[model samples]
Target: MSHPHPELSSPPPLGKGALRVVALGGLGEIGRNMTVFEYGGRLLIVDCGVLFPEEEQPGVDLILPDFDHIRDRLDDIEAIVLTHGHEDHIGGVPFLLRERPDIPLVGSKLTLALITAKLGEHRIKPETVLVEEGQRQDFGPFDLEFFSVNHSIPDALAVGIRTPGGSVLHTGDFKMDQLPLDGRLTDLAGFSRFGDEGVDLLLSDSTNAEQPGFVVSERDLNEDIEKVFRTADKRIVVACFASHVHRVQQVIDAASQHGRKIAFVGRSMVRNMNIARDLGYLSIPGDTIIDVKQLDKMRPNEAVLICTGSQGEPMSALSRMASRDHQIRIEEGDTILLASSLIPGNENSVNRVINGLTRWGANIVHKGNALVHVSGHASAGELLYILNMVRPRNFMPVHGEWRHMRAHAELAKKTGVSDDRIVIAEDGVVVDVYKNRAKIVGAVQAGYVYVDGSSVGDVTDAALKDRRILGEEGFISVVLAVDSNTGKILGEPEIHTRGAGLKPDAFDDVIDKLQDALDKAASDGVNDPHQLRQLVRRNAGRWVNETYRRRPMIIPVLVEV
Candidate 1:
């Protein structure tokens, strides 16, 4: 029940025979998941991922977990265990690898394949150890075991760590879907075995902890998808996460049943599907998927286009089509299905895309209008079941917002876990488990490291604030010529504005005031060009704020002749 405070000091040296856990990201937010486990001076990392940019983070490509905590200690790392292949779990691997390229990567076959493909783009040949649901490996002081878990994507795993300090089980984003499309059920029996062996610490997913009941099975969406295929008289377009193999399988099945050809749009969609198919995780019928270029050759009713942008990313294929900027135009009578749940911060963007598509006379179906999507995380009931089953000495809820984590902590209390035994921590908070108990020790630097185009960690908050001001308020520039020796005004100052919501003649009112201010500063012996520039900025800014009530960015340029 401890929360982070501004006065929390840096954690003390790791106690002898103790395991210290720190989450660099994915505690208070839903994305950029990473956790560092320290034992006997060695580090084991789990799930390095990235977060998508929100509306306020303009021009940001991605957000990464701050690696400063381990930047200098990279050589002490044993390995990085990837629990799944989702972007929020594995997206930051390549960036981390750039610091230390030889760290062994451990994950399932499909997960490894996805990351390998991604790393290939970075021109990095990684050293990886391929594992599966039932396997065990030892890395320095950490002994790892893997268990099968059902999720939106195939080959998801939950990891178990055994150390001299204690035994910890991390359920990396799982749900109890009894009738999963891939025939893989969450290993409840395996969890019971871990309980029998005594689980000192249990970290579970909390993304859906607020929901009241079990999550609807992925199989349940088949009937609704079939209905969409049967009723659509024109072309059908389905948008989902590029990594959702099961959803794509459902779309492929429905399209095949209705005798329609399918095409994969978006580069990520094509690449991920190709990897899944090659690894035997995705099954596509012969000639079922054709190139996107051939989409126009078939009749309207005979084609199904599956693409990305279920969350309405600006550059995604579905968003481009909605804006009429792509090759596939949204014509009348077109049926579009958004097959993925919306991420928390993407609601406005998704709504904008939906409005754009609706304006073109296309019918839209989504989680709100129809049961076209189901959550990939377990709900309250399933969490209660796991809490009762594992019966661990300490519990930590990961992979959710604060409210979701708080709700999950309450569920743990109801299942006989004491309030003191539950640790509700945010990103960068450090928790140490020893002698079968866990407590908060201190905190670390876990701020957002923005990724702009071809740049990482270079964009600062002050820069973003200036960009916001320019975008929202506007910009104004003032140029003046000055006499260096006499410290007198040479001529009238020139002013111009952009995006300031003012007319050209608006500068005429401020020019005289600026000249007078410059002359007064010069008479007072302020001959420095920098000082003159500051005077001009102050004078012009005051006039604008007083006259127009707008706080636009004002730049002053002074020339000394």
Candidate 2:
């Protein structure tokens, strides 16, 4: 395992004129995988993406990388390079386009197809350049080469970027699949070719660094899906990731084998399936695909429904059906298959949906129950293989949590990479690689920008904390009217509470005590609105905490007429 180098023990202060690398996101965390490569005042961005919300981020729909660092240097941005079409890798492209339009996007045919569809939804028309494997392009001071890589999604690539300072090879979310569904294997020879030339810095994916051994192939998972189709008696409903085109293809093949028509039940699933089929990445038999509305037209045993919400997202089509809120409800003896990996931190929510479905007598079949899902990331052994192949002078792990990144660094060391050659970084930490030396240099403003509804970067930490408090303890509002001339209380104080863990009748005695306190304060000539509000909040809050053992948000209102 690689340890921190003694000479590079601490992050150095920013120096003038060096090759700078900044991770806007996808370091020390998962999702929102973005990085900025700077050379000679020119910027090249790789993978502007978004992160899904956790339980802590209440009311947040999505999270994006803060664009403050690049907002002023928009003109210097040469192009945006996309490695794949996953939401975490391409979801934020529209947001970036909103900031600076006319920047050309470069990626594989299918990757650009998915991104173009996404941009159309946001009413954006971007200049797109489609490239295949072995293609090379020059943008300003940067020269980029694309190579094929096998992942859960089709047309995924690993990028090789050449700049004046050094060269970086970014393995964008890949696994070594020996037998991929499309018979297209990862370009091992291409990775070796880059290795022969000597890479300066390698920013690799660390998503599955902690997992042991190599990942199972998508071909293995396809056979399992076929087995389930042969055994199932009734209609089959599968919940999977919408962007995983390979898994979707397997499901379509399985459905056709069982002589069933397929119906996509989610917005993303429907849209992506159409895009994949149109681009030749997905194959469907003639009239094998049908609309959701036509599901009733076919017999129960002749239909297969592939939807989203394997993670138990509330708004997903599977969740709606599980909760009996969708047009089609789960029936007795129906088979519900979850053909997706259970992402960390989503176990409880996924289990809740499973419980709901089982209560309606549906049989639950998931990755735990069957060999239906395989990860799209390289495991420890595969990471070691890549490290040995690339043999980069300096290494920085990306696209995983801190633990994953650290584990990847350890794997690199096992492959003969020295501690001094490994550079583990957090989000926004800048690492400068020169012709001979590389070290972490200073930091930048790389924070999460929350997206709620139509608003982006508007939700703050304080607001989310307040929402959590309200959810846990509730709130109280105290309304009082003051006499304008007499400086006296007009009437008894009105106390209203909601979700404060207290009933209306229970607050009667508390309200009486508060009214008396208000009258006493008024008699003492405390007619100032601010003073009265403070008095009410302090006394009412203290009394409530003492009596109920819980502190609710106390809001005091003073009105004079």
Candidate 3:
């Protein structure tokens, strides 16, 4: 008889193997927001996300969770439920499905539409189950009800997965925006119903866990933005996230109110806007929004440009315009409204854009104690309110930093949630909920997988370390000859070095100093290639550090004679 590995079975089988929440990443950062609900051997994932690596991690583009622990159980992974169309929540789906095909994905109509489009970009399309708000679906052993939640992006929702353990509310990025620009609010009624229905375990967004009070309403932005638009007599280039349909709607309304035609620039902004408008999610009056190519015939005073790169993304139209390289130029009196906040890790890029706008005689505005961008996550009061609404026996805070999760957990304690009820987890940490309590159940192989261009999971720690070393020091290449039998260098050593030239003018002269050092030093009795390589590397590092104030990566090439 063939049997599965005993270790792979359910963890100790406690309390009917009751409701369990697994945080693969979202617990400790703003990006890569994902949470897993497991009950009765059925697994449903919410928001497969990816984080952008910090500056310390060079050459790495995006960081995704390593799913090897659950790779073998793909069948149990019934569906991937999305919260919104934001990159952090939906970016990793394409990479996640690369290994597991034929997986049913569940999200809102527009969310699924955006996800389908993203998959199409990869030339790999799968069946994405389009579940609207208030839609219910049942997998093998669990029942889930998804409802709309207002956020910066349209069609965002909170999920209620009902299992035998209890109903677990996975509040994806949301806020209590009563007067949302999109005219939809986070369903306090449905949430109240869940509260009335009795929730056993609650998993909520802790991204804003540290924030004290309720987040400022999204409605406040319209007043300031309307003011900006009303006063602007010249062409206005507004930058924001493409998925932020609510913000886009507000921009459209502002443009309409100002009697200015709208034109979308940048690929993603244009594509998402067209998709939303075609799907009737966004309504722009006839020729109210023109394409950039069509802008040639329109007067600049009558144009309101809505484009991507509010974060100052390099390829975005805003960046191109800032550089004065785009087909559309912002002459004097031009106004550039950076309607998005500087997402952490993108300060340099966005700051560069701001500098460029300033240099090019354009007025720029962004998040600086201003009402341009409002966060979507719930603050402390809203967090407490959700906790109180659900009245869950156990609370697991996901989607924030250690400080954030801890802050929320502490607050949960103050809100009548017992000490055992609050379980703060890190990335890959698992918490089991049974009979009104939550506790850790060890960790799984849940870490990040870096995506660098054509390579997936190629940006390894070792690679990143090597890059860091190269950046910190410089790079030294040692080419030496050794006898094959004796393991000794038979000739003079050739030392080639490049002061890790992150730029052309960074460390050009350090190579000359390294060459001088090698020319002066004599070969040692250590004929072994390995030993000689080590010696050369160590010496080169010391020399570069002392002389050029840089330590480059040292590469020793030993050729045997």
Better of 2 and 3 by TM-score: 2
Clashing pairs in 3: 26-399, 28-400, 473-551, 473-552, 474-500, 474-551, 474-552, 474-553, 475-552
CA shift of 363, model 3, Å: 0.5
Residue ranges of candidate 3 with Cα displaced over 4 Å: 1-15, 482-491, 500-526, 546-549
Q: Give the candidate number with the greatest lDDT.
A: 1
TM-score rank order: 1, 2, 3
Q: 301-410, model 3: which lDDT tens digit per residue?
A: 79888888887766678899889888987788888888876776788988888898888788776778458888877889888888877787778887787788889898
Give the winner by TM-score. 1
TM-score of decoy 2: 0.95
lDDT of 2 by residue, 410-444 (tens): 99888887899899887777799887467886677
Residue pairs whose backbone atoms clash in candidate 2: 474-499
Model 2 spans with C-alpha error above 4 angstroms? 1-17, 484-488, 516-525
Regarding TM-score, does 1 or 3 come out ahead? 1
Worst 10 residues of 3 by lDDT: 1-10
Give one clash count per candidate, in the order shown.
0, 1, 9
